[model samples]
Every structure is written in C-alpha cells, then in structure tokens.
Target: MRSLIVSCNVTVDGFMAGLGNDLASLDFIVPDSEQENALAARFREVADTIVFGRQTFLDMEAYWTKVDSDMAAWINATPKVVLSTDSGADVSIWNNTTLAAGDGAERVRRLKASEGGGLVMFGGVQTIRSMIAADLVDEYWLKISPVAVGQGSSMFADLPERRSLTLRGAKGYPSGMLDVTYAK
Candidate 1:
C-alpha cells in the first residue's frame, strides 16, 4: 500500500492558522525560494497524488496557480484529489486535479491500497484530522513553527483512540522551524 502522509505547518502553540484564519504571521515559507523550490521538486518526484480539502482547493487555486514560477505551476498542476461536498464548482486549477466528493477516509484508504505513487495528504486541518481519526494515515511530516498562537485553528484533533507513531527523523531549520517525520 502507498503510504499516506499528512504534511502540515503548525505553530508551537499548536495552531495551524490564526483564530481568524490568518497564517501570514508564521513567516517561514518563502514560496519562490530555494527551499520551496527543492521541496516542490521532490514532492513531484515522489508523491503520486496530493490529498486536499475544500478550503485547500480554494486557497491553492487562488495562490499557487498564479505563482510566478514553473515550480509553482507544477505544484498547482500536480494530481490533487480533493475531498469536497461542493461537486458543483469550478475546479479546473490543473489537468490532474479532481474532486472526490465523499467518505474522505474510506476513499483515501482505497487510494492508499491501490497501485500508484506515494500519497501525500496536505493538511487542510479538518480533512487531515478526519483521516487521522479513522487511523488511515501512515505517516506524518509536521513542520513546527517557533512562534506560539494563544488559540487558533489546530493541525491535529483529539481522536477517539490514541494512535501510535515513531519519530523517524527530525531537523531544526534556520527559520526556527522544526521538521519532524513520524511513521506508524
């Protein structure tokens, strides 16, 4: 089965974005920089599909689609399997992108078990959390920001049972971010 990895950037205080949905304060990612460039290159090289959420679909199309580089467009154009209820919207952000409208966890499990490239589930919080709760996620690539958000939208939610994970690797970035990789 292909590994299901949930990759997200969260603050030290456990917030994924601010209370009002503002994420600009966590200023670590530079879109067109060497870091983002290399990340995108590797993401394309490894991940077969990108799991996204409704909000992610909107945000990505709004930002990444209009980005100033091919890497950005590549990121935008890559296969995105979004979990959305709105099956009647404009989702033609890229050729491979598609909306897979129901049973997020079950659908994801089927995708992971099927033959394909590595599966990467981008953290659109709610959707990712749902997968986590369903015990469908195989790995987690979490980027922990240095700053603290008193209270805001969190990356992970409390599931019914405690899921197990082992830290496979950890790296401290120059921008005060800690990149941690965990495997189940």
Candidate 2:
C-alpha cells in the first residue's frame, strides 16, 4: 500500500487560510525563508506522485509551470491526480496530470492501495477535509508558522471526530516555523 501524506503551511492559530479563504491575506502568510524552501525540497524527495484538488491543480499549474526553480521542475515532471467534481476539467495544460471525478474519498482510498511512492497532497481545503473525514491520511507534514489568524478556514474544521496522531519528528527553524511530522 502507498502512503498518503498531507503537507500544509498553517498559522499558529491552526488556520490554513485567512479571511475569504485567502492564504495571501495580511501577514498571515508564512514568509519565504531558506529553511522553509529546504523543508519543501525535503518533502518533494519523498513523494513521486502529487495529489491535488482541482482548484489547487489549476493554481499550481498556472504558477509553477512558468517558474524556473527546482520545485517547478519537480512539479512539472511529477505525476498528478486532481480530484474534482467538474468532469470537463482540462488537466492537459500540465504534464502527467489526470482528473478524477466522483467519490473523492474512494478514489483516494484506491490510490492508497496502489503500488507507488508516497502520495502527497498540497491543498484546496475541501479535498483535504474529505480525506481527513475519511481518515485516509497516513502522515501529516505541517509547517506551522508563527502567526495567528483569529478566524479562517481550517483543514480539520469538518472532522467527524477527534483523531489522534503520534508526533514522529519535529524541527524548529530560525524563522519561527515549526516543521513537524505526525503519523497515524
């Protein structure tokens, strides 16, 4: 079976996005630091497949494809699966991308059962919520920045019940970002 991992940059207050579901709102966004970039590179090393929600897929395709960075290269070359309700979603704009519509949780479950390297998810809120609700996540790699947004959307907001996770590793960077990993 494959491992499904979620990588999120969250505020200290536990919000994934600020007002109006904007991650760029105010100083709520984590500052781009070398340590953070290094951490992301580490995450990229573990996952050969990237799982995304439709909006995130489009957003990333628009931005990453035009950039000239190692992350951009990895994203363009990696295989991606976007979960969306829109059957007409055009995934051809990006390389090695596929669209999976209907039963998000089941599709994720099926992916988890497939033979592959780690499956890592970036975001799109709704998709993360569904995966959390279905308990399909095997590991969570969270970079909790030192910022507090009093209110916003949370990945854990709609969880049906409390789920406990074991802290597998943690590292504190000078940028005040806590790079932590939790496993079920």
Report lDDT per candidate.
Answer: 0.73, 0.83
Candidate 2 ranges beyond 4 A from true positions = 24-27
Query: Candidate 2 versus the native: TM-score?
Result: 0.91
Q: Write model 2 residue lDDT over 23-90, tens digit each, in one string.
A: 56535655655655676587577888899998888887888989877667777888999998888888
> Tens digit of lDDT per residue, candidate 1, span 51-111?
8887876777677767777567666666888887666755675667887877888889889
TM-score for each model: 0.84, 0.91
Off by over 4 Å in 1: 20-34, 69-73
Q: By how many angstroms RMSD does model 2 differ from the true structure?
A: 1.8
Cand. 1 Cα-lDDT: 0.73
Q: What lDDT score goes with residue 181 in model 2?
A: 94
RMSD in order of candidates? 2.6, 1.8
